[model samples]
Target: MIKRLICAAVFSGTIATNVNAEELRFTVWTGSKAHLDMLNDIANGFKQTHPDVTVRYDTIPFGDYVQKLTLQMAGGNPPDLGWLLENSAPAFVEAGALADVSKTLHATENYNYADFSTSAMGLWTKDDSVYGIPFSTSPFLVYYNKSLYDAAGLETPDQRATDGTWTWEQLKKDAATLRNADAGVWGYETVDGQGYSARVWHNLIPIIRAYGGNAWTDGTCHLDSPEAVKAIKLFHNMIYVDGSAVPPGEQGDFFSGKSALTVTQISRVSKLADANFDWGIAPLPAGPAGNAATVGQAAVVAFAQGKNKEIAAEFLAYMTSAKNVAKMAEFFPPARKSVLEGDAFLSSNPAITPAQMKIVAQGIENGSVLPSHEHFPQIEAKARPEFDALWSKDADIQATMTKLCQGIQPLL
Candidate 1:
């Protein structure tokens, strides 16, 4: 009997050691307050079911996230798990710093790949393999001050949500109606120029795609095509010819109620909730090709050097589960269709309407993921000066785009 007790004690000690070995470290660059709170909740939830495993989370600011992540990867000490933006994933994937998470994600029963937007999935896939599970997925929407619109005797933008009739032409007309210099208000405000060139690119890409133009073709820059040139010309016209959108330097006016309409990400709803005026959101105005699209932000990935890959993947699975994803929607929309369509997810935020959510869902489903090549950063760098010139109405569209493409081609 004494010998049996000794054997049982040794077995118990072995189990304890095994359990203690199952710890994971995850790094996320999400800096939003609501997102961080939801992440903590998910972590705590994981700990409940996974008593043997411990998860440690580290936060990084958005500005330094990529640079810091790159440095850590170069030093061969990347976190067990990290957040990867769609625009930045290709570069890291090319460096072989990310694990091919396809198999692990596929093995999980509740982890449904089909439920995520194709564009969201496209961001983390190279060739035929997927590297990450999508997290926050957003699409551009029109946020308008209802008081401003009503005071101007204008119809609410939400009226056009179902028919996709909110065109650039209509938006311009509405902007003209709302402009009032004496009251410090304008019809529309958008972030443009080199300082916020990505914002211009984000809004413009949908228009380009809607007009049947590909931003890049066969791994080469194709922004100089007839359709693309027309798209750029129209965008330029909005600021220069239409007198509807505020100039680049005047973006702050919109946040201060100087503009009636602002094109922004759905994630900004939280920020706008406390504004002095009543606000409403509508789907992005449709373009010529009878479709709409928007740029997506970031997803979650696993590092190649992670010691606890299995546990890391499990944690990711748990975090992205429908229940957990519903919690995350308090900050940003979850990537899963199941979560997006569920009553729990929809009922959490009464501020966002079901119609608006449908528009976002459709936009994400139809959206194109931004292409990420090795020289993408370089391409963006070279293109910005010309885009700035275009916005300032000083550059010839054809000549500028042609030159920009030439500079980007060599990088590709």
Candidate 2:
């Protein structure tokens, strides 16, 4: 009777352990095989320690990522972990949508949490609580067609950068000279050619910062500041006056060779794989204020409302460990100080040379993430029409920007 009772007890323990096995669902915006393969490898690494867990990544469209994630939470089914854009970090942190991973991050053996740069971590942390970890702090760069520059008989941005003569004024001059109306080529394309509508802030903020202005400072709207007005006027002239930039409702793709120059980042290299023209990436041109090195960032976050918060936080810690981060640097610019300072990051991307990668490293070191506010969505909504107005030749630059501030000030 005693032996039978002991056997029954052992069987029940086995059943309970089997029931403990859990699968975590992760959300991401990338559907790239290389990215997914790396992620799966990381997950497999986690299983080496916690053999009972499984991780699955769900690809969300970039346009609907935040909204759909929110809906899933509201519908009682939230992803255990997910990617969050820098623009959404402030709002998500304020809304209590992300789990606090500080404990897991710090308690992990040899994690070296302090290896992350303070400037790079600013958007993901508040006081002592870490809500997210940035995986990419990609800087905006100037990608110019070498073929176009050679044919136009002009010194390329790289040459200008080497001599410390690259500036917004020089960029304007090059754009004007490169304009070839008969051949249907544009001199410049703004943020994937959706500048006038979708990427309105992205299209203007770098220029605004270069001119020593910002969207806001200390809860005050400064879109109408004289410096900002001057910056907007410069881009307006590029689009309407000189007709050097691709105007609204037009298709001028830089990767497709229809545009001479574009301002973007290294992640777009895959788009240039089969390009017809030779291209080179240079640091962003300096304005009167000097190099701003504006960056767009993204991070990984564990959802506060997830069913498996503890395990998700553990996975987050593993995924962002120094080794894993260095591994991810092949595709994503890492925020880890150790990785960024090492030799691996310089040659991570085979498509780009070490020289061009140096510009990326310097940019991340000196860069600031895109301007963000807790009420960013509201600010973006109110400024859209006013921003749209700036694309016209007859637009009143100062007054239009003033109106933008008026609409955004109440939210700020």
Candidate 3:
């Protein structure tokens, strides 16, 4: 009888342990095989110490990321952890949607929370609460097709950058010269071909900043400023007058060899791993105000409503440690100072040469994160129609910008 009781107690304890086992769901926007493989490798490492834990990654398309994430939360099915863009950080933190991982980070051995720069942590940290940890403080770069440049007997963006002659005006000239209509190739493509719609800010902010203008400041709108208008006109000319940029209703993809140049972050490097043409990355072209490097940032956050918040935060801490951050530097440039300055980071990816990686490092050192506001979603909604009017071949730059400012000023 006593032997039977002991066996029953042991079985009960085993069931209790099984009940405590966790499966964390993580959401990301990337569907790249390389990216998912790297992430899965990292997730597998967590199982070393957390033997009973498993992590599942869910890939949501970039265009639907924010809206779908919100819907998931509203439906009480939020993932335990997810990636959040800089633009979404402010609103998420304000809404208490993200879990505060400060304690977990501080408690983790050798987590080195201080390794992340104050500037890099600005959007993720609010006072003493850290809603998320920035894993990618990536800077905008111009990726050019070296094969096309060679065929055309033109100096590449990399060469021009080295010669200190790579300016916005020069890029426009190169784009026009490289345009190959018969080959179904465009001179340039905006970020992911959604630049005119979902990514309009990503499409225009760098140009505006390079021209010595900003979206807003101190509760004011600057899109209607003289500098901003001049910058917008240059891009408008590239689309309509120069007929260089892949405009709205077009389907040119830089990775598919349909465009000569594209403006995007280094994370897109994964898309070129098996490409047929030679490609290289360069700093954003200099403009009237000189090279105004802009960064697009994203962070890993634990949802406050997660069923297993504590374990999710632990994984977040582990995923962002110096060692893991260095591993991720292959695609998502690190926000951690230790990893950013390490020699290993420069050679993290076999696809990127150390020389090309230097351009990424330089941009991160000099760039500012893309503009973000707590009212960003609302502001974006208000500015959409106004920006839509600017896509026409005969659009009036000054007038459209004025309307955009008028529409978004209240939100600002």
Candidate with best lDDT: 3
Give lDDT tens digits, candidate 1, residues 161-224: 5555677667777887887768877777773222245455665676676666766877777888
Worst lDDT run of 10 residues, candidate 3, spans 10-19
In candidate 1, residue 155 scores what lDDT? 78
Q: How accurate is candidate 1 locally (lDDT)?
A: 0.69
Q: Which lDDT value does model 3 have at 82?
A: 95
For candidate 3, the TM-score is 0.94
The 0-to-1 C-alpha lDDT of every candidate, in the order given, reads: 0.69, 0.84, 0.88
- Give the alpha carbon lDDT tens digit for every residue of 50-98 in model 2: 9989999999976667667666665556678999888778877776677
- List the candidates ranked by lDDT, beginning with the highest: 3, 2, 1
Two-way TM-score contest, 1 vs 2, winner: 2
Clashing pairs in 2: none
Q: Output the lDDT of residue 344, model 3.
A: 93
Clashing pairs in 1: none
* Alpha carbon lDDT at 76, candidate 3: 51
Over 1-412, each residue of candidate 3 has an lDDT whose tens digit, in order, gives 2122222332332211212338898999999999999999999999999988999999999987887877666655668899999998887776777789999999999998889889899999988999999989999999999999999999999889989999988999999999999999999899888889988899889999999999999999999999999988998999999999999998989998999999998889989977899999999998899889999999999988777888999999999999899989999999998888889988998999999899999999999898888877778878888899999988888998999899889877
- Whichever of 1 and 3 has more TM-score, that candidate is 3
Supply the TM-score for candidate 2: 0.89
